[model samples]
Target: MPEGPSVRKFHRLVSPFVGQQVVKTGGSSKKLNPAGFQSLWLQDTQVHGKKLFLRFDPDEEIVSPGNNPLSEPLQKEWKEEAGHHQEVSEQSSRSPGGDDAVPSGGDGLRCLWGDTPAGGAERWLQVSFGLFGSIWGNEFSRAKKANKRGDWRDPVPRLVLHFGGGGFLAFYNCQMVWSSSSPVVRPTSDILSEKFHRGQALEALGREQPVCYTLLDQRYFSGLGNIIKNEALFRAGIHPLSPGSLLGLPRLKALVDHVVAFSAGWLRGKFQGRQQHTQIYQKEWCPAGHQVVKEALGPPGGFQRLTWWCPQCQPRLSLDEPEQVAPSSGARAPSTQSLALEGP
Candidate 1:
């Protein structure tokens, strides 16, 4: 699972398509298909948690569910009707029409050109790369190879976003579709933002789940996944089984800061050729000469991913009490302070 930090990198990687016109769009994901696609400018792209959102500037008309929106007379008619109603709505209100854009949801791909007309979307694509899902194409062949995804041409893609510039974005073996625009709460902070500092981490740590589980929660950590979670715990010298409420303010804050800093450094190191290696994510031993142990740490869902930890580093402390471990000399654990802010 790509965590917040990884997703931020993905956002940067896909930015080349921005400002380009959507000459065409198609995908196998039921959420998105042959139904509605047109030429629209891909204005920007963003990631909220693990979800990737591609924003297209609003178009003059909305695509009905069962129609080929780009088709002849129907497209023209929809545009005319949309324009007329937009004019009337604008004249009737002094405020910006709240209906100018519709948000999105679900697992798949979406593409939009610009500011959506009434009852339309501002996104060109709302892609939720489920564990194995991804967006790739001939244009992004090099990127695909870098991600070890073979190549776009190898397995024939189910989704294709054709840009007016003659370039296209492709998706293979991914669930692509259009998400409904709805109002909902999104993750509070992306790991790259200043908003995801010590204060925010402290709030997330206060959850009742074990320390490891709290970090895994997307609602708080957004992009954090099993890999980062495992390595972060080992680095922080904190036990994964420790109850969140039992963690001391200083230790919890330090752990949060360490994870945040590590995430940023890991992302930066990937492109710089800095040894971008994993410490103990899949290793059988710790850097300190201890045999790494594997354990299932979540509630009985049978979905608990494998957790690797060093006994010498992270002790199995009592859940009733928070045990503070001395930060290992070889590890980097930046001390931090809580802002006394409320928890989410």
Candidate 2:
């Protein structure tokens, strides 16, 4: 899946469409399962971590088919598979701060759009490109339709957003939603941000749990993904499953620093016409000639993701003895990168 930096690129691509009046709107995804979306004017666009949010004005003008221009095209697919009329639940859309919105039930992506606290109203289309999903915007004149499996029809778009002026934005293999409890607003700082919260990162990482667990926690690094975790840990010379609290401050900080640097480097690579050269992720051998080890991990029963690292580079600390200098679950250890590796 494309991570936070990639999602930011999508935001930039469609931001120019802001203020355009939506003439017809509708699409389908295996996960989104949208009922249908009515045409409304576009307002704004935002990117938070790996999610993209599109804002629309709520003043929808429903007109008679005879009087509507492109009435045929607009309604042709809005009712495509019989489930027309996607709506935001009154409870979810109207919630203050949107914390109560549940993210688990429907689709790979979720959105919550409705009345803001100040009485102003807005509807949003939120999307996340899961492992293989891709989003692209093309002109209406060249748009193609989608087949039953969400693949692009000969020349029609997989998802079409027709505007009042005969222009359109076409999407392909993407998941979009308009009702979710997940907050749509982004936090003030993403992990790669200039104002990164070292205190918060440290607090989030200070634990006996696996180091990779904290690295993948959205609360700590909103944009961090599996690939990022592997690369960042390898760069910091830390093992993925090593105990977090045992990585003395200096080692922990090194890991945190690489996360931000590698994240920024990922984006920079795109601009430079290539991606960052990963050392251990998905590889069988490390740069220093050590056999790379792989692990499958996650919360119990969940689908495990693959994690790769050179065990020789990222040595785990022993949890057994007080003589070993491992911190107690609540104790903060002093900074040092030369701590002895735990014996396997």
Q: In candidate 2, how many clashes are counted?
A: 10
Clashing pairs in 2: 101-181, 111-178, 111-179, 111-180, 144-155, 144-156, 144-157, 145-153, 145-156, 145-157
| Model 1: lDDT of residue 171 | 52
Expressed as tens digits, the lDDT of each residue in 145-240 for candidate 2 is 454578653332346677766555655545556642233342433554444566677777778878787776666676677787888788777767
TM-score each candidate: 0.69, 0.66
- Model 1, 1-344: lDDT tens digits are 44554455455555566677777666544434432456556665655555566655445343222111112221122211100000001011110111112254563324432223344455445455544444543343222232244433333445677876667776544333344343232434444444444566678788777878777665566667787788778777777887778777877866766666666566555434454467778889888888888877665553467898887778766745455456554356543321111123
C-alpha lDDT (0 to 100) for residue 216 of candidate 2: 68
What range of 10 consecutive residues in model 2 has the weakest lDDT sum?
88-97
Off by more than 4 A, model 1: 25-27, 57-124, 137-153, 176-187, 273-275, 319-321, 334-344
